[model samples]
Target: MQKNLLFYEKVNKRFILFLALVCFSGVLFAQNKTITGKVVTNESDSSLEGVTVKVKGSATSTMTGKDGSFSISAPANATLVISSVGFLSQEVAVKNQSNIIVKLATDQQSLQQVVVVGYGTVKRKDVTGAISSVTAAQIAKVPVTTLDQALQGRAAGVQVINNDAS
Candidate 1:
């Protein structure tokens, strides 16, 4: 009788622990919130597809659908970052916001810029150093499978050494 009572007490304690774990899981699920939004171009007033949407201070991110719609689940009061090429970046406050519409202004000046030098990027007007531009058409004229092979003898100062000897 003493052994049976001890066994029952152990089972009861496990059952109580299981119930507490289930309740905690339920509360955690309830705390999750959903954020949905649309990304559009400010100038054209058109949907911008393939825009990356990320939760600020977190690694959670999602891409906009073909129609520029996106939905993501996160905790409440989270901040969000919306970014895309050729558009101004935007950060939004997500507190109490279930549905949002974001308008990204066009970065007209950045579209015409060029990257120069090895360590820095400069606009066309701000470049004080001599710059050489390489185009895809010049690279396509070479009969090579890899870009490094195509780059050979194309740029005056550029050097590409092939290390694949195997």
Candidate 2:
């Protein structure tokens, strides 16, 4: 009889421990809150999709949906960072916020800036020399591996010919 009682006591202890673990998991899941928001361009008032939305100081993040909307679950006091290419990054405090709308300002000055020439860099407003700007799309259209190879036949006044003789 004593051996049976000891076995029953061990089983009861394990059952209690399992119950406590389930309760703790429920509490943890309940503490997290969902945050949602939309990201738009400040200049054009257009929705910006696929933007990266991250929680500050945490490894949690999400990308904007097709309509520039995003949803993330985090603690109430977490802060969020919204970032995209060619736009100014924004940081938002998420205290007591269930929903938010962010308007990202375009870094127009970065797009309109001039390139460096010869020995010095000059802005587009102050440059008097002839300059040409090539975008990433233009560079991707060519099938060359090197800069010298891609520049061949693309520029009007530039010529590049490979010499094979040593």
Candidate 3:
């Protein structure tokens, strides 16, 4: 019976040690960190509100405040993806840094691709007006000073008349 007790004591000691090691490892491997940053527009140098700041490869995310400031809890080595409408998306690496500043450029492709009508702007495919487009090549062929002269024969239902009869 004494030998059995000794064996049980050894097993209990090992179990206690294993539990302690697991707890210690949990403390060591904990990598959650608070990251703070500001997002701004590159062209205007103004704060970009409502920007989505997300930790890449994770579900952690937040939106910027009205002053373009944001704070998020993420892993130490995670990448942050910042995005907003009418601006380019940016990815910044945390790399143990506490504070960061992100500047997003304007997305010209998306901006110039939109068609502005009298009421609201619409995409190229969503335009429902009697719209006409003039290409640069067609403009280059015409050596006119004014747009009315350049578009004399280019668009349908458009009349170009000289006010001075010149």
lDDT of 1 by residue, 1-100 (tens): 9999999999999999999999899887787588999999998879989999999888899999999999998778888899987788999888788999
Off by over 4 Å in 1: 1-14, 114-166
lDDT of 3 by residue, 64-124 (tens): 9999999999888899999987788999999999999999998878666767564588886
Deviating ranges (above 4 Å) for candidate 3:
1-12, 116-166
TM-scores of the models, in the order given: 0.59, 0.57, 0.59
Q: Which portions of model 2 show Cα errors greater than 4 Å?
A: 1-21, 114-166
lDDT of 1: 0.86
How much lDDT does each candidate structure score? 0.86, 0.84, 0.88
lDDT tens string, model 2, 1-166? 9999999999999999999999899987787799998999887778998899999988999999889999999789888999976678999998889999999997777556967675588766566556666666887899887776776777576666766475
Worst 10 residues of 3 by lDDT: 124-133
Go through the candidates in order and give the C-alpha RMSD of each one to the true structure.
10.8, 9.9, 10.7
As for candidate 2, its clashing pairs are none
If both were scored by lDDT, which would come out higher, candidate 1 or candidate 3? 3
The top-ranked prediction according to lDDT is 3
